[model samples]
Target: MRDPAANNGRELARSPREPPSVNCRLEGDPTPMQVAKRYRDATPESDRLPAKKARLLSTNTQQLGTENETQTKKTTLQQPEPRRSKRSYASFLDDFADEALVHRRPELLCTFVSEWLESVESDREKHCRSDSHLHPSDEQPVARLRTRSAPVMVKARDIGGFTVPPTPSSTGPPSFRADLDDDRSRSSSSSTANVRNPRYRQNNLRFNCIHVRHATSPLPVTLSGHVDSLRAQRSSPGLSSDDLNQAMYRIDVLAEGCDEEQVVKLLDDTVFPDPEGDDTFGPATGLMSNSSTLMAQHLVPADGASPYRVTQPKPDRLYGYSERTVGGAFTQSQLLAQTMLHDRNPDYTTATSRGLRFPFLAIQFKAVGGTRGDLWVAANQCAAASSACLNAVHQLNISLQACQSTRRVDNLSYCIAVDNKLAELYISWREDSSNYYLQQVDTFVLSRPVEFQSFRTQVRNILDWGKDARLTQIGDALDVILEENRKNAAQAAKSRTSPPDDPAASAKRQKPSSRRNSKGSQSSQTQICATNPTLPEAEAG
Candidate 1:
């Protein structure tokens, strides 16, 4: 029933006898749907870039960040590198662009850009000092390089520039690869995430970026200060500050084909350019440790701005603070600080809340007189104390400064601490009624009024004394005796029972000898002769 003409046309299309132009419409000049499908397929591969680049760009000095990198998700971080006093970014980029164009590393070239015109994009205080070593995959084709982080200001010269060459490689270090083959495994963008144990190896890294721009018109005092503080410093191990110097040389080349107005236009075009924009420069990240540190420098009262949200942590766990007191600080930086604060439960008073009964850390203040017991003077009186016989002096002090309290008497303070590497345990406890103790219920609570002295020592001692406090020694709590009692009940019941004896054996067969039997009824015995041949009369005494 089909038309011959239609059949012939379909056959022609499949047979490869069709014209090339028709084929182009079907495949080459893709429809939006086809383009979208390709993009979907390409994304996994796209995510691979950061993983490879992160491993690639990191020096031994930068490697310490690797431990945290895997646990975090992609986010933008603001990195406002101090700009050099006499440097011109416009001139520098123009020159850098010409060289990259010559070399043709389009991927890197396109990403290096200034999107400042589009508000650029809402895009490291040190603790310890140590040499950093970047670990590579054990499966290799390379060498190792050792490096360390040091602070320095890069100087931007006041001149036209030339091309800067790539610094020699610093690939010597240890061996470390994310266990997950796909480094981009953590693509989920959730507000909260469990902080990874530092020992875990993560392939996924949080990618953060930001851009900076300044006017070419005239130099201002504030801008000068910014530039002077932003330059790269020289290191003896790998690259030198001169490499940044050479970046200026490339700027001269950027100025070659263009005039001042054109340079301005280029800078303007660079702002928020499409994905394919020029790539000599970009919003650099990991240029500093994290976004919060950057924000504190920019938004904190001293950083010269009315308070703003510019530097807040990305809405994810890897870069967050646990305590509201620590506020929006990065979780890593706040770990130690957070550890020092009072936990959700200061005591086992609320058996239901975590940390209640979980071991605490005690810091007994020695300054207050022993008799006054530290908190007495602070609270101003003894009878005024809240709990009877409660030497309980709960205070809230950070760095030993007394936190104000409405409590008129002995207000003691307490805090917990953790290991220095931002490694910590958020100890929480749950009362298990199914087993023994009442689950946050009224039963089993000691009859005595709550006492604070024993209380203060209790939690701190648990953590301090550790498992020893929790260990069940013989006859400790009555519950152990009760368990033993149950088992004994079954054993006692079995031992007390006995079986009845059988009556049938030989006695029933001997019934015929009745007359000769020595026994007789009580009346016959009284008569003394009926049942037996002779018997003495039984007399009542």
Candidate 2:
């Protein structure tokens, strides 16, 4: 008999390895086997890996799919992937219906369906051809339609109107791979994609609507109430008329030729006093100036080559605590359980000191002579930063039980784009889980002492509110979420450990089977599973 080790050595010594049996390349990319063959051809035989090592490596790599004489392996064993936590289109529709009922805007839902149907019909007409081939003349129209649909779908999805088609299974046929590739290409061009160049107008349509609203445009009741409360706040009693005069004088002197750093220093000294410097402010407040420290990766827009890579917002002035000051302390086991259940860090989605938990305010400051263009750039930065802040709260809300009434509160975050001359206050809120809105509430000419004072007062009020009201709200919500989590754990444990039903009792307990009801219930359960797998079976029951 031939030596088994010699046969293995001969196999490993072969010039070109057999390629994977799967037909069709990935987007026309070279297969791994082809690349390996090329590398082997270029390298000298003497310089190649030792025959024993190469054989061992090949055997190890192919072990998942390699066949023994007893059976011909047709499939590789793979660890099952975790199900994605994304909510489904049906759940989105339910939320939309609920929102419409609450707002008494039933017409909105009708309009949404009509618009979607119209677009779909138009798309079908453009693509349909007698020869079953697209005409060159129709290409531009089809392209335009696709371009328009991408944003529409992104916006609709954000607002709970768009539906994502079901993803192809991993074990699906080669034909299914084509659909997956098409989806990947389509998503790349969508507004929902990770953007490298963060343009305010180009990337954020909802944000644009908020910033462009007319001065007289009515705001949401909750938002308007917060705005009014901000306006009602009085200026610092410590800041007397003399203090205002001196600050204004200093600002006027620096207004002509100050750099960004000088402007930041001037404001820090005169207008926005350091919270830590004042004993009254205590540890409740935190300030980070010109720090390029990165926030949580998921919280910010992905702008790097890798989707998971961190993006730094690096606002001029960041005002928020480094940690949550309220909420019940979690034991180690409870923290571990939370980590396993939600795949969350114990930091509550915050990464570092610059994470700025529950940040209510951010400032993007420029030099005195900064142009309107410069202010626009600052606004973009502020918008990105403010969105991250809102996202942190939204993630926390996701952890709460579905039965909870209050998951999120709006108008909790605000940003200011300011120079020595002009300052604009923008309030940030979420219409739903994904739709983030940032609207300009007020503008102030810092050159004028009255407007400057008004600006200072509003900033102070926002900080105070964040420290007290916002923190309390967040703390209460966190406690409730933790309590719900505990309850869920206990119930799960009980279900697992409770004694099995007695067979004698079970036989006696059996009732007349209602086939109609049984079918209906099973169908209902199937619908729930298909549309919302994230929902626990216990909850569904």
Candidate 3:
């Protein structure tokens, strides 16, 4: 305290411009030590927004990456797996069994197995090494032993006295040596082996024999009393020819095989019974007598002993109306055997046929009833006509070539539907193309109570159109098709034989044209010079 202010003033005077020390403090401000203590105390409480935001962003980025990876994994799982090749061989066998089952012939399985085994053996033989220890002669004894058990072997011995020879000494075991004869004997044995080893030939012959026997066997006649029953039905009072025609159509549609009596009985029981009325065609003796009398008059031949043949009935005569005339007797199938369709058994198995061939034409008469009837039913009739037409075309194509001469075979089909008041005729034929397609040629309608004469005229017009117009059109179309095919074949052959285009040759050809064009331009310039003498020489050039 001895003069302290004066001492501080003396220190300041000594260094007037000297800066203050870092730890020095102003009068009103806190001291440097106090500020440092304050900063240290508040450090833990300071905001850290940037760091927090960075952490949140990093976590979101990681979550997005994980989600992307999960999405990629899900996409991979959604795809269908590729097919394996190992199952193809099993599928082929399954297909083979299915096809064999379709034929209803289990023997086909044996045939397929035999063929497969033969093919496998052939392939094995082809791939086998020639120098291998397995000698071809070693397998002969097994084959010979197999063939000797066959029934054909007995027949072969009786026919040719063919016998299997012993194995050559070279191929036999070392202990069992056999002497060889002349070369002729070896040649004879080789030839015999070649001829006798093919056991399939014998099997084929046996199969053919069975097929021939089955085909030639006559179908049993089951319509012994069919005529009698039909006659009985015809004599029923109030029954018209239309009813009779309907009955015949029903019979034709339902009958299968030669069982006409059964068909008639079924029709009587199911279709023809008049449920609404008491008067029905049931099995009655009185009706049979009347039917027999009617049968003797019309259906039966003049000679009662001759077998009755079914014929189309003549049109009924109307009072005060003249009779209509039609040309040619129209024949319809009254029995299954007479129809053009293939015969089938009750099981739907196709019956074997003899060599006899039926005609190509098939006609069905359908009766329309009520007001418009079903449009779908009418459409089906068209389809039926088309099918019949195509079947005829196929048969013709197989049996005969297109008539090279003027005798054109008209393959047309017709389905006629008639009601009490209206009649419709549908005509169909095959159109020309790479494949035959059915086409409706025309549809004709006639008012009900139509005269037979008008019907005949319309039919004759259709026949004429088919014979003259349609046939000629088809032939012309066929000719055009054949010509186009010939042209295509020629073009194909020319393309196959022609040389490839050469760029150098094409350039050479272009050069000549370019020279000619230059010459043409030069001539034109000279002509201009002659016409305009005052023109400059450079301009003319």
Candidate 4:
């Protein structure tokens, strides 16, 4: 009898004595025998199928086992490789722990500054320009006059000068108070009484004089009357109208003595002062000096020699305008520059004759409240300071070149915002351009709890970090971490969008018999079986 497995065409082996080869062509559904015949035909003669039935059977079993093992190996090789673990901020900090410690050391500040200076010097050629044109100067003269109804008389003695006395009211200018009847009556009565009484001699009359010290000069002088009266009395008897006008213009009247009306008229007619060609006559020097002093106080030791120094021809005093309008024209920081940096001289124009030192660091500090308005003001102040530093550095560089100095001066400017809860530090430098401009290097925000001790420590740490290279490293590390997080989020989103393939699930779906029937179908089948229990037996009969 034929083997059932052979009839079903499942066995690949046959008697070796019957045939070593069989038809390779497939009919209907190909059998294992047919598949074996194809494999035998494709192989080399030395590797041909075995002739003996037992040997063929053993060979087929070995070949099938080898094929299964190769398929397993292929599937394993095609599997995806595992991804590398992402780094965390904590691990990054640990890697550079020693460098962080080095950066925090106070002793390294000098080294950092030296390195920064060297870098500036190396890049000097890029910023240094051949153009010698000065910045377009903006000079706003402060208005010093105060309005008053009555004309105030400043004695000549107060201003440190002598002037001719008034001619006993007879030949004086019109009285300031025209509506006063007493003055008119006195003038008429005195004239008549003086003429009637021959004992009253004009030449022997004694005059009252007031002595006052001058604002600018230390010397004192005596004045007989009002400056206008003195000037009227001093006019020549034969002088023409034009000549008298010229003489009045030449007369040096103290600013304090000028009437409100006269002051307003002068201001309306007077032209603004021309821009000072040299730095000597303008307010720039004073402003620069004040700015420098503020910087030195915060950045350097009191006795230590700083790499940068602020200079004005007269560092001893602020510019005239600065002194006159201290609080009005400038901010508290600017006023501090004027008053704290130099001696409080009433004379605004008085200053040290010495010129500014080269390579100075300019600093400006602004106090900001938590209010939005204060923040806006602080921002503007910083911007203005940046512009000033750029201009100053450009001028200094040009001056150095003009003097043929070997030292290359680079202007470094800093703007600091001080607040109880927050602090900001900004670094800026001049850009190489025909017009003066400043470029901001960086802004550091130091945030912490508003405790004084901790806040102060935080500020110091931020400053130190800025000076060292660690700040840049930390920034880079943060950027990398953020990028990795973003990539991870994207991969998660992609995975959520596409469902994973399941081979077992697909096979179960294709073969209905492998899946369990729904509840409704199962209930219906049970009911039919209960109602017709003998149906299967009747069909069998």
Candidate 5:
């Protein structure tokens, strides 16, 4: 039907290398031929090939493109859109999380500080005694030298600042022997008058009704008095010469510039050595002698003005207070004190299953290259922890006083700061109900043999004291309080059962004990600062 001349003209209009243009209706999908033609036309002329190669390339491209498009469509249809949910109340609070004051407004910070300082001063005035309170004979010696020119070295005698009086001569005058014989005969006759079972004494320690007598009008005074009294007394023998030599050998093994963790490990190994294999350190004592490096998160922070988050004290090691060590004597009282005596659980309550409990001895360690500033920081931590221990005992004292018990608790805690070069011992005690005090006892250089042995001896003695003397003191106080409580309860029940007409019963009923009436007010007096006492800083080398 076409003219020969028109066909020739169409052939001439298209180049022999160029693919033909695609022709299709716009409303529906195009045919494969049309698609191939579209792709070929859009591609560059240089990319176009002749013969079978051009046809094969177009077919492959068309097949891949179709498969990808179909896969994408299927994915889109199968997946549903994510739903939007409402925001939480906490999410709304995020905007003002950083704000401290009301509505981000500032006030007089100086006024707040001044008022706090005044409260501290007033509290100190209540219980702390003035320097005039100390008699000339009771006065403590000047502090030991801590100059950078020479490393510090001290012994137990220097630390306590007391001389042990020469042992009383066993060989006295002839009359002394005659007096002793007479006293023995009189004691034997008195023993026959009253027959009672002899109490078992552990380690021959005097744990009977023997009491430490105080003045007739004894009033609670600052902790400095307690420390000074302790300083004036003779200290007990601690580590043997052999033990000191062994510890010194271990210390000498430590290299210079050791890290903190290394120092901790070395000190622990040197002081509290692990028994080899399972042979055991003697028999199973069942008492927890020591614990180490556990976080004290349950206690309140000592530094309230920290710009960042408050830090919990994690002492390198703790000695002499555990459930087993106390024999659970304080368990019930600790729980009762949580609700009755304190605003919160006392700082000594760690609230952990296996944590250091009411630790009497705490230690802090820094790297070998640490400075005196670092040691002071460690001292501050020790002060806070030691203060907590004293506060716990002080709270018990308050409870006992309420029961009309004459017993009073006056105890001290010890802390040692150890670093590459120096070991500094510090003592902390409750000065009064509202005040506490801390003072450095002694310092020793680790590298030196003489000083290190002294340090070792002192530390061992403290550990021994905590395990025996201190434990007995705390246990006795708890037992006394429990006994008083029982007595009061029995008296209360007896009065209730007495005849209504009885004058004694009537008098008792009419006048309720002031202690019982003022129980709620005790919380106000129980408040005490757990911060370290400021120490005069020695100049850095």
Candidate 6:
């Protein structure tokens, strides 16, 4: 040995590092020895890393191929094709290795990369050309300049229609190193870029029909019966008009002004008294000064206070006790129809959208049909005075109850009848508070009728027929029709002015008439002017 380390160092210093030796540059059909020598001289240490990586990748590929084969056999549909073979792992690495050699040798690199790029572009173009899922015409790049992060959260969803939660403002988007994250979001966004897809039109059409009806039309309705009392366990004998006033019920006859001694004397004479004292009602004051503060208010047998049911033996003239009063209770409701909303700024669909709210709560008189106006004063009064609660919710329950009574309309888009048999007297609230709200109530169901449908159809037809429809489709159709009409009118005017004695021109002219149907065939409504076949043949004549 001749001091090897020192000799190697001297050799390295002598070469001036030769730009790290363009690693393993392939010569024209170079032999293995030449290639190996090139690799070694290119720098032994640098070669070790790539060699190790190559071994690892090769081992992984072999293992992946084996497992894939096993899986292919295990799967039925008699077995899936092995993915690793399809992947062409060895071939892929071969290309990469070839490219590295080319880079070092210049001449080879250009040819290999060009071939690879061509294959990639061809595959990509094929995919792009076949795929209609994306709307390139509408696929304008998203304006990244806008930020709606702080907008109020209404509702949003992914392409699958599943709801996604809003992201936190503080956490921010993913880290810079997150490579797949950007691609994932981009893919998700691209999939939904076609905002005018037919699905959008369908969804908008539904909302259009529903919202417009609710906003413009009235709802269906029904009322619950008073027969609930008959089936109820508790027996409330029901109230008379006077019983409705709770104020007058608890009063007792007494002196003008109440004093302390008078109150004591009344308590002693009347209700809860000493064993030796009398019970009575009299002027009260002092401790009993509170309006409801009567002491031991006495009760007598109640012939005077109880509702006089003369039937079953209250032979004695009883007085001084009271019974709780009973009042009636019931429910009522209204159901609004669905409708399309208006659109000043056109949306993705032909139909517009608007939300229907509560309808005009008016009074209808069954006996006097036209008398009831769309006023709320009388209805509100009835709503208040009737046993039924006057809230929209309570009214809804009443309508449901009323619906249960019959089987005519089940979907309940918009309808209701107010034929509550037990309803003693119905009153509707007045819309105007300036006047007293005392109007008789009638049964009126506020739903869109057939005429309403015809109106909507006519509007849609007009939109389709006229250029003023402001839609591309409708405008084109209109232009064609107008052009044809103008031509026809001009020809008709020319025919009227033609010289009367022009025999040839007259002979050439044809009269227009309605079309005729042939045997077992439907006739076309329109007809072209043609000469009659019934005319005598010139030679025969």
Model 5 Cα lDDT, one tens digit per residue, 48-157: 55844666688899999999998988877343457653222222233322222221223322333344455445544433234334322236543455766985644334
lDDT (C-alpha, whole model) for all candidates: 0.26, 0.60, 0.35, 0.34, 0.52, 0.28
Order the candidates by lDDT, highest first — what do you get? 2, 5, 3, 4, 6, 1
By TM-score, the candidates rank as 2, 5, 3, 4, 6, 1
Return the lDDT, model 5, position 22: 21
Which candidate wins on lDDT?
Answer: 2
TM-score for each model: 0.15, 0.50, 0.21, 0.20, 0.42, 0.15
Query: What are the RMSD figures for all models against the true structure?
Result: 37.6, 36.3, 43.5, 53.8, 39.6, 34.8
Least accurate 10 contiguous residues by lDDT in model 3: 315-324
Q: Which stretches in model 6 have alpha-carbon errors above 4 Å?
A: 1-82, 85-92, 95-105, 118-122, 125-387, 390-541
Quote model 4's TM-score: 0.20
- For model 1, how does the per-residue alpha-carbon lDDT over 1-541 read when each residue is reduced to its tens digit? 3454564455446422111111123322442223334555666855756755565466554666775674453353433357854323233343334432324344333333432212122211121223122323346424755669655845443334433454435544333234332333442321122223221112111111111111233334543442233222222122134633443343345433433333223222321111112231111100001111111111111112211111221110111111212221122322233233344423211111111111122211112111212221211111111111111111112212322222222121112111111111111111121110000101111111122112222332322222232212111221322333445666677656743444764466566456456455544565656556455545410
How do the residues 223-296 of candidate 4 rate in per-residue lDDT, one tens digit apiece? 12211121232211233456434433522241224332332233212211211332322343222233223221
Please identify model 2 stretches exceeding 4 Å from their true place. Answer: 1-200, 203-216, 235-238, 284-290, 301-312, 324-348, 351-355, 370-373, 401-408, 504-541
Candidate 2's displacement at residue 22, Å, is 85
TM-score of 5: 0.42
Candidate 2 lDDT score relative to the true structure: 0.60
lDDT of 3 by residue, 1-541 (tens): 2354564454356422222212233444542323444544566744635865686689899999999998888877343457865322233353344421324345544554555455444544542354244445554432324544555433222234454464453866554443334455654553332212343123322221211112123322322131122223222233356754564455454432223244325333322232123243112201110110111111111222322211211111000000111211111111121122222321111111111111111222323333334323333333322332344334334222432324334544443433322334443334341222222222333221224324434433433334344444434433443444456679899989997899999999899999999999999989989999999998886
| Candidate 1 vs candidate 2, TM-score winner | 2
Candidate 6 local lDDT, 104-207, one digit each (tens): 55644455445545555444444333354442334643333567676776877777666779866556446753656777875565433222233422232222
Mark the 10 consecutive residues where model 6 has the least summed lDDT.
Answer: 328-337
**Candidate 1's error at 347, in angstroms?**
30
Cα distance off (Å), candidate 1, residue 465: 2.6
